[model samples]
Target: MIHIRFSDNNYGGEIDLSGTPGDLRSIRQSIIKLLQAQDVQVCIPANEVKPAPYDSCLNSLVIRKSDCSVKVMVAGSSLKIEGTPEKLKVFADWFNFGDSTESGYHNHFDYYEGNEWVDPASVSLIISCKYRGTK
Candidate 1:
C-alpha cells in the first residue's frame, strides 16, 4: 500500500509499497512522471520576509527518491494552501497521480549456467517540505 501526506506547515508526503519489485518500480516511475507533468520546482525562500508572517505565495516542490520510496517537499514563506485530502485526491486522480503497470524479469541461469534468483520488488515514498523565513 502507498500513503501520501501534505501539510502547509511543512509540506510533504509518504509512500509505502510493500509488494512485488515490479510494482515498486512502476509506482516510482509513475510518481516521477506525475511531478514532471505538474512542473514541480524547488522553492527557495527570499531574504526579506519575516518569520511566521500570514500571507500566500507560490513555492517550489522538492523531490527526493530512494530505492524503496520517493519523497516530495515544498518550502516557502506564508505558505497556506486551501485544499483537503479529498480535494487533493480528486486533483491527483484527475492528473494520473499514481498509475503505472509494466513488468519484466531476468534469469541469471540463462548466462550463469546454474545461478538463478528472484529480485526483491517493492517501493516506498516519503516526502516533506519546509518553509524558510527571510531576514
Candidate 2:
C-alpha cells in the first residue's frame, strides 16, 4: 500500500493509496486533492525536446519560497524536496504518478535503484507545508 501523510498548520491526515505499476488514477486524485485543499499551485515545467541521459524531470524547477518543504520516504531512506509551492506539488505528483497511465509526462523512474524497481508496498511519503502569505 502507498501511504501518504500530509500535514500543515490547518490540516493533517493520512491516506492509503491503491493502484498498480502502470496505473495510478486513484493516487493522483488523492494527492491533487490534498494539494488543492492546501491551495498550493500545481505547475509543470517545460521539458527539453531532447533530454540528455540521466536528466532529471524536475531539474528545472525553481524555488520561490523558503519555508515550504516536502519529503518522501522510500524504505528507510528519506528524501527532501525544496521548491516553490508549484514545484513541490509537481514533485509530489511525479512521485506518485510518474510513468503511470495517469501521467502525461515521461518516467522519472525515481522508484528505481540502478536497474531494479523498488516495491510499492515499502514506499511512503510525508508532505509538510509551511507556506506564509499567498502561495
Candidate 3:
C-alpha cells in the first residue's frame, strides 16, 4: 500500500493508495483534475478589463497541492516548492496554463478559453502523472 502522512498548522491528513500501476496513475490523474477544477479564472492584472475594473482583482492563488498545503519559499531570485511528487504536479499545471499557440506548454484542463491571450480572459491547465512505487 502507498502511504502518505501530512501535517500543517491548521489541517492535514494521510492518503493511502493501493493498486496496480495503472490504477495508481488513474488516482493521481483524478487528484490533479479535481484540483484543477477548484481554480476560478481570474483576470490577470485586472486593470486592463473594463466591466470588473479591479472589482474582482484576484492576483493570487492559494494552491492546495495536497491534504497539507506545501510550503513555498522564495529566497532571493530563486523559489522552492516542497511537497510530495503528486502534489507538485497540481501547481506545475497551473503555472503552465495557456493556449496551444503558446509554445512549450501543455493544455491540461483546457483552462484557456481560446483567444484568452487577446481577449483578457483566463481558462487553462495541463496535467500528467506517472505512478511510482508498489502498494
Candidate 4:
C-alpha cells in the first residue's frame, strides 16, 4: 500500500493508495502543475494577540486534500515529500526562491518547474485522476 501522511496541529491523517506507479506519477504531476499555477507570495497569517504581544510570527500552513486531490504550499523546490517506501514516491528537496530582480520578497517554489511565482493568496486545486492507457 502506498501511504501519504498528512499532519498539522489540529489534525493528522493519511491516505493509502493501492494503484499502480502511473497513479503516483500523475498525482505528483498534478501537484506540480497546481502549485506552479498559484501565486508564489503566499502570506503566512500573523497570529492575533488581543491582550498579548508576541515578537515573532507563526509558521502556519494549512493543507487541504480530498480522496484524489491535494492543496498545499511549498517553498521553492523545498517541499515535504518523502520517498521512504521506495515503492511509493520521491520529490526533490531544494530549488531557488529569492533570486528575482522584482520585489525581493523571496519565493518558496515554482508552479510547474522553471516558472515565475504567482500571487501568494492563490489556492491550488489538484484533481486525482486515473490515466487510462489505450490498447
Question: lDDT of each structure?
Answer: 0.25, 0.31, 0.29, 0.26
**lDDT score for residue 55 of model 1:** 26
Off by over 4 Å in 1: 1-16, 39-135
Q: Candidate 4 deviates by what RMSD? A: 18.4
Can you write out model 4's per-residue Cα lDDT over 8-105, one digit (the tens) per residue? 22222221111124433444444444345543222222222221121222232222222221223333321222112211111211211222222212
Per-residue CA lDDT of model 2 for 1-135, tens digit only, reads: 222222222222122222242234333454456456654332223222222221211212211222433332221111223334454456545545433233123343233344222223222332222111211
Which candidate's lDDT is highest?
2
Whole-model alpha-carbon lDDT for candidate 2 = 0.31
| Least accurate 10 contiguous residues by lDDT in model 2 | 126-135
Q: Estimated TM-score per prediction?
A: 0.20, 0.28, 0.23, 0.23
Positional deviation of residue 38's Cα in model 3 after best superposition, in angstroms: 2.0
Q: List the residue pairs that clash in candidate 3.
A: 1-135, 108-125, 108-126, 109-125, 111-123, 111-124, 112-123, 112-124
Angstrom error of the Cα, residue 59, model 1: value is 28
Write the number of the candidate with greater TM-score, choosing between 1 and 3.
Answer: 3
Q: Predicted candidate 2: what Cα RMSD to the true structure?
A: 17.1
Q: Give the number of the best model, judged by TM-score.
A: 2
Task: List runs of model 4 lying over 4 Å from the truth.
Answer: 1-14, 39-135
Pitting candidate 2 against candidate 4, the one with the higher lDDT is: 2
